[model samples]
Target: MDKMQRMEQLVEQLNQYNYHYYTLDQPLVSDKEYDLLYDELTALEAETGITLPDSPTGRVGGELLQGFKPHRHLAPLWSLDKAQNEEQLINWNNRVLRLIADYNSKNPDTPLPDPTYVVELKFDGLTLNLTYTDGKLVQASTRGNGVIGEGILAQVKTIKSVPLTIPFTAGTIEVQGEGIMNLSVLAKYNETAAEPLKNARNAAAGALRNLNPRTTAERKLNAYFYNVGYSDGIRFSSHQEMVAFLKENRFKVNPHVTYHDSFQEVIDVLHTIVDKRSSLDYLIDGAVIKITDMRTREVLGYTDKFPRWAVAFKFEAEETTTVLESVTWNVGRTGKITPLARVEPVELAGVTVQNCTLNNVGDIERKNLKFALGTRVFIRRSNDVIPEILGKVTEEQDGGEIVYPVNCPACGFPLEQRGAHLFCNNRLDCKPQIVSRITHFASRDAMDIETFSEKTAEQLHDELNVREPAELYTLTFEQLIKLERFGEKKANNLLKAIEESKGRDLASFLYALGIPNTGKSTTKVLADHFRDLDKIMNATVEELTELPDIGGIVAESIVSFFADPFMQAGIHKMLSLGVEAKPPQQAAPVTDSFFSGKTVVLTGTLHQLGRDEATARLEALGAKVTGSVSKKTDLVIAGEKAGSKLAKAQELGIPVIEDEDELIKLLNGQNE
Candidate 1:
């Protein structure tokens, strides 16, 4: 067949596979067959020189949006004043007392009201706004820049914990919540995950902001809506009453909350949370204490950005004794050498944490976290956020203090101190740096060359006499099968993943290129501006840094990638394999702000405007149409309920729009 026909067939097959994998959770073909087809299609696309819109190549979407258009917050989401340490927390206690004294002065005859503080676990997850009307859930948004949040109302409903339709009958209420995933699911996800996740908080935060809602759902995420963002026609005089109302409305409110008559009681609860922090399913970084009485809260009101009624009391990180088996170092993309402690497996939080970050040699000195072989050290994983060594030796553990390494642990090169960081200038040749770089190249956000997993990568390097990402394509199906643990099926699947990765849109490839600070978002902007991979490869530092998000480091990385004859050589090999990359066609600058306040939902197959076109248009305007309808949605544009979002939108009272023309007119600054 001609390259065009070949390309066309591959698109049809790959699109179907993507729908099955991404949309249906079922893949039809075996790993090897899919890879061959994917590889063929990528070759055809490169040979024919045409970019497809629905191509899986376009993941992460195009472009880091030129500085987000600011949307006026319905109710300004104020920042909370932080108590970084115990001293600040005590000052907060003193301030709460003064406020109560001032309140008593006005009603001298009445006994001084025993003011109460409600304490709740401060979850280490993404904060969101959920809007409800007449007890139906409508909209959900991220606290993007505090003033305007990304309207992810569609993604929000996919989360089963977030009620699409409220159980209680209330006019209008804004529910505040923390979107989090438990550690059990996190571990399970990491088992099948593209890579081992850093921590639960990063995983949870990444899940909420993900482009695909299906990903959000599969993670088994849940949330606890604690604060009343705003509720109309609801008469809740106290914080306790509001929380009770939330519970009555079938909302998942934090059950740990208790009303305290004094700061001492609040402190007691804080201590209790710190003690119990290691056992909770969800990570609690701190305790959020708020005034219980609404009238008292109003009296305290707010500062320029924070409410005076509430404060977050972050506890000192919980530390426990663990015997350090050894210390290892990892070289990062930024060249910072990070020290890790291999500890005796201990169940500190909900799971057994094995490795703890020592940060750097300076950190070792500062925390006295020095550890020699077999040294007993105080290990702390703060709220299951990140593990750290509290201290190493002396009377504390009767362990020997470890001497910090003065040379690069990997290459044994003399390390130079730059500020707080220690660096190994060996760059890409270093083993950790090479593995990390190659791994990054095959990442989901990057070139997405899935076949090069850690096992396959290790096998290829240590066993198959192969090294680096470029060597991946040269891997024969038989070679993959020959590796230990590699059955015919697993080998075929890995090959398919590699084939599918070829001919990705330039955005993904750039991200995969492992440029410093230049990942998914940065890749899109560069792809559009450069319009070709060769131009980007040849770009000067001055030329690269000109893009919005691409700063000095990123630009330097780009310049370095091309300069590294090694990286350039890899790109050439990839191109020779028909793993071509190209820029997307730039759409016209939109003038209509129709999307300004509208919440739109697109369904079924659109003709005039493809899914990508429709989404981009709506986003350019001021409209905040989400993927699903909740209490906050104004309308739904249904072509056909291709996805689950359509059914949920209908179950709610969202006004459904029919086609692109209707959406266009509505967005063209027209009411009709």
Candidate 2:
């Protein structure tokens, strides 16, 4: 092949590999192999003076820019309305539905149905508007006030994930996406830096707006396309179609985007994203839910600031800067000495955070944390209820040095240093430790005893001398009534709740036992493997380690916990006091089912069964029910008003069952 042709071929292969590695998480070529091919392309381009616009060589780095020019967006890039909670999200959905209803009322002949929503992750990064002309990248700008923005084409070219050229030659098209710095990239960058970046969002913004493109390239920024601000000679019936078009043109569209017919499903997706936020490689502040139908979005048009058809359901504040007041030590059920930093109350994301976790003495030392009163410290809260200090934000230090406590804050016992963590050995006599253990034992995820707050646990521990979980079952209504905030009715309710907790499942009982490193999921795994408490207690470290997902640390923790005389006595006492731990029921084998080993996606409205019911039924038949329709989907059971998913399934040539009757027949091994 000629030099230009060879470069084009190389670009195509590299782009395909990039898509597989980044988007699909399944790389076809090794990094070393990719690098060798890329180097050859770079050398060929340099020798022949023929550089392909979409070649991977362009992402190496660019010349430093003197200044950024201004670019006006063809169409206004409106912000999304904010929804801090589920109720707010529902209200926004209701308003959009109401608007659609009004439009239907005006035009009765062409009535609009309730619109499906396209939910996407709201990436916490800098927004970039990319404009393409005649299949070539022309302009890239930041979202400056929605109308006009600073041009950053030089810096944008460094993002390897973004396509430098697309296949659209009709006219101009504007695509909006977020430029993000990966958490891993940020950590690597901060290793040798004098002043580290504050957060990923700031790192992205700083990199994108940097005067030096080489610096920006070194940051290794990534982008994910979400919206099309403007398009010419192209038409999309829905947002889903537009996104699919973007993906077809080799844009790095987020794979997490899904189309949901019900608002509850959208909310569920939002919650799921929030729960899995910490596990994600990138930072996302919230989930954006938008009306999928293009016509519906037009009807429920834009307000002054934000689009009426879309809303951002934000999670609790992940990052904020607050003044550090002092540090306090708290004793946990495990007697671990955890440092709690009391900070000046700051509103982050939406919640006010006053106290943040310092984790341990080692963490404080590594972060170079100085608990100087009045100094500003960066606090970050992940999926945890307690926030944690990231680092100091200010230089002015007024407070004294933070001194590690020699003795336990609750009891007079000396703190013992153990592998970067300090622990209090007084597990039996420490008041705070006792209170925490009891409180955790009766927690919702544990024994699930209603009306058993931490304050009530403390009260019971102090007044009634209740030290252990078994003692809780022995408390009488009269004894509870003597305590403060405990009337006759309240006392009766408390006693009844404790009594009702006796039938808690084996997993819950195991978690409630306060075994170190054993969480709810681990407890379930243990319970499923052992089938009973006795089997779990009798299992050796080797056997425990052999269980799925149970490692040496967890296995040793479990075996040691069971071997402890105090723990054994506590379990026996609880069992004697009528705490019946029932083993979880085993699921029936599904190897004989017709739908076994298939992946199914249910979409639209089912008449004969609810969505959850259909999902459960499919799962019971050994079919994995997924939320979105992808190339991996074997079958899609679409019902009435089937929208994006149905269209996608058809486009991908995946088999589809039209109704619940068809699905049921398929499950019965009847060919449709």
Relative to the true structure, how large is the alpha-carbon lDDT of every model? 0.68, 0.83
TM-score of each: 0.44, 0.60
Report the poorest 10 consecutive residues by lDDT, candidate 2.
643-652
- RMSD of candidate 2 to the truth, in angstroms, is 9.4
lDDT by residue for model 1 (1-672), tens: 876666667776776665443223345777798888877766766776775543433332333333322333467677778897668877986887787788788778753456777888898888888877776666678877667887665456655555555566648777788888775567566555544444567677877777666666666676778877776677678888888877666566655677777777878778766755554556777888888888777777888888988898876545567788877777775557888788898877556878888777766655544434577766666443568765554434345556666887777878888766788877545666666766777876677766566655556666875646777778788787778888988888888888888878887787777766564556767877888988888889899777655668878877876888777888899889878786776655455565566766666667877765776667677554344445456666655323334434433434667556776676566764
Model 2 Cα lDDT, one tens digit per residue, 1-672: 787788889998988887676654556888999999989988998899888777777776777778999899999988878988878877887788788888999999988767898889899999999999999899999999889999999899888778877888899999999999977678677665656676788889999999998888888998999988899979898987999899888888776788898888987878667655654567888888888988887778888898898888877767878888888988888999999989999887557888888888876665567556567788887544578787777544555688999999989799999976999999888998999999999998899999889999889888999888888988887788888878998998888898899999998899899899877657867886788899999899899878655789989999999999998998999899999999976678597677898878777678878675776677778886666666678888887656557655654557888768877776667853
Clash numbers, per candidate = 19, 1
The 10 consecutive residues of candidate 1 with the worst lDDT sum are: 60-69
